[model samples]
Target: GNRAEQKEDLRQLVGLTAGSDDKALLADITLRRASMYLATADYEQAVKQAQQATALVATHDNKTLEARAYRIWGRAQWQQGRANAAKPLLQRALRLATAAKDVLEQAQNYYDLGQIAFLNNQFSEAQQLLHQAIDLFKVEDDKRNMIRCLDNLGSIAILSESNFEAALTYFQDSFRMCQSIHWPYGETYVLYHLGNCYFEIGDFAQSQETLGKTLTLTRLLGDRAAEANALDTLGLAYQFDGQLEQARAKFEEALAIHDSLNDRRGKAYVQTHLGILLSNLEEIEQAGIYLYDALSARSDSGAKETTIDTEAALAWLDMARGDSDFAQERAQEIAAWLQENGTAGVELPFQVFWQCYTVLKLTGAAEEAQSLLQLAYTQLMARTQKIQDEDLRAHYLESVVYHRQIIEAFEATTR
Candidate 1:
């Protein structure tokens, strides 16, 4: 509801009831209003209402309601990407809920904490916490919360573990449950994750198909953030499918939305992707511009993975422009960083390694080229096996074949 409608309703409720005497009821209503504000993405109003609720409930010795208020406040912070700030509030909620023996609130706190852990890239901790929430939700017969848990678990599987098959199974189960419950919103989330899993597994066709549904549903729901994310993933699907023009259009559209929203992280991510796509298309000058811009954005955002990815693209662009010495130096720096920081099982690092192989091969650094080619070939082969679709598998295998051809050519020339 709008603020005016909510205020009018609250006024009527207070007038009809005994006003200050109904402290518990007022606190409950305030918490509900806070949740409504949170749902509308009004974090400031949500936090304000939740604080009011907390004050009201504190006077009445209502620990459960106070815990609920804290949870709402923490959730608002989490939605604003302040995971660190949200954690202590959620933990306090959990502590209070545990003291009150409020099983459902405890479960909710666990789920929120799991989300924080996932955002922090602590996948094992997230999995453990989510499993706890799922178990508690199942015990309480909370089907909706269980579905959310399953969806998040699927995300952890994909983003953390890189287990696309397992992630797909989780998403499929969650999707079926959402359908059974007639929850279109839940279904949309499940489909979005399914699309991402398909993309990760190299099934671009299915990825595009699923993301198309997600985009349609997000549009229907009028969720700009969801729409932007769907478009971003759809762009990746198109890019992987070799549809460069379609990919560029999708990326541009997503970028425009992110820009309008002032979502710096989203803009940085999309910019990195666009830089990579332009590099692959051999638009060297434009690619260099985008790559450098993306690098700056990622660095500002402290997005380490994306920063490395943009740097890799820029280095590759240097090589494409016949600056082999500069490219080699950049590639060596990136290789050292990857070794020290680890790749986090992401495909970008492997793509960087492939570029490194190309640079070394062309620069007549046979020993370095052979070593990097072997590493890239192994990683590519492993990734190819994850693509269950035969055509997609073959498409992905072409990279491995190219790597082999380069290696063979090198051996022949050297011999």
Candidate 2:
């Protein structure tokens, strides 16, 4: 039985010989190191390890090892917020797994690919991939993976505009599955997401209750990453409810954790959230500082490598300062990139568009704001697939709802 220390040493030894002649051994070692780095939120390092593993597969003609490498590499790339990069890698992994007659590997590939597509706003593609993975998991009698796919599918439905009731159904189904399996991780994760959905549909009480449950579970599990996420969402819930002080406390606590972990992505999230919170409180100076930090990070890291939240935060701050010239410039840049990446209807990034609309409304650019807001509505309304997980669907809904409200307010201001 290998203890933690032994595991650590074994991992380091594998890393040292990862470039050696033993292709199979190198692939396994590289994957292991990638996992270790991912667990610690060292996304770049994980990508490096995954790439090394990928290289070994081609060099040695190790098809089996190559499949695993592609899968791990895709996951690592996704963690770096590069869903576009991850998509094709996951596709290749799926292809390799199918060719090798590895059902489990195929299921994992579909599951990951589905998630990447969902994040990139390709709901139709996400649903298809998730369904395939779900079917495979069912045949393998792997309830865990089935529940995961259900959760993801449910989220996609909630984010998409069409068929809210259907999306809710999926969320319920996913929640029930997690409950039946006694999967604490899924239970908490789902609840956190569900809370967001409830928030989106104006079900503040339910959102608060579910989000609270998620926070409790994540704390019990000692999962700092999930805890931070729960806190951020919970804070947003409180903010929506006019509990500004409580929201601030939650955001601050989340920020502390992200900083301590040195998670750049998490830090970027916290900074963006903090900027938004301060802006809402009318603390213009402090908000400017936080927003600048977020934008600086986003610009330095590359847009694809940073969360949309950071870009949105900076854009909002720019608007708040009446820097319409710069804000519009950024919006144009984002809109072009989103279109180039095949995101339609809402060609502007959701959060950033709302910010841009807000500025336009405030500046009495009613016609322009209305045009953009209509696009958002049209994009959101065209989504019709049902997501089959309660918690995750809820989170997706919540995000949509929050942005929706921003658009609504923009429209109202014009009247």
Best by TM-score: 1
The true-versus-predicted C-alpha distance at residue 124 of model 2, in Å, is 1.2
Q: Report the C-alpha lDDT of model 1 over 127-206, residue by residue, as the tens digit.
A: 99999999899889998889999999998876665556677789999999999988777787889999987776666788
CA RMSD (A), model 1: 4.5
State, as a TM-score between 0 and 1, how close model 2 is to the true structure.
Answer: 0.73
Instruction: Give the RMSD in angstroms, all C-alphas superposed, for model 2.
Output: 6.0
Q: lDDT, candidate 1, residue 300?
A: 62
Kindly list the per-residue Cα lDDT of model 2 for residues 308-381, writing each as its tens digit. 55665666777767787776666555544543552432322465566656665666666776766666555544
TM-score of 1: 0.81
What residue pairs clash in candidate 1, if any at all?
A: none
State the displacement of the C-alpha of residue 226, model 1, in Å, after optimal TM-score superposition: 1.3
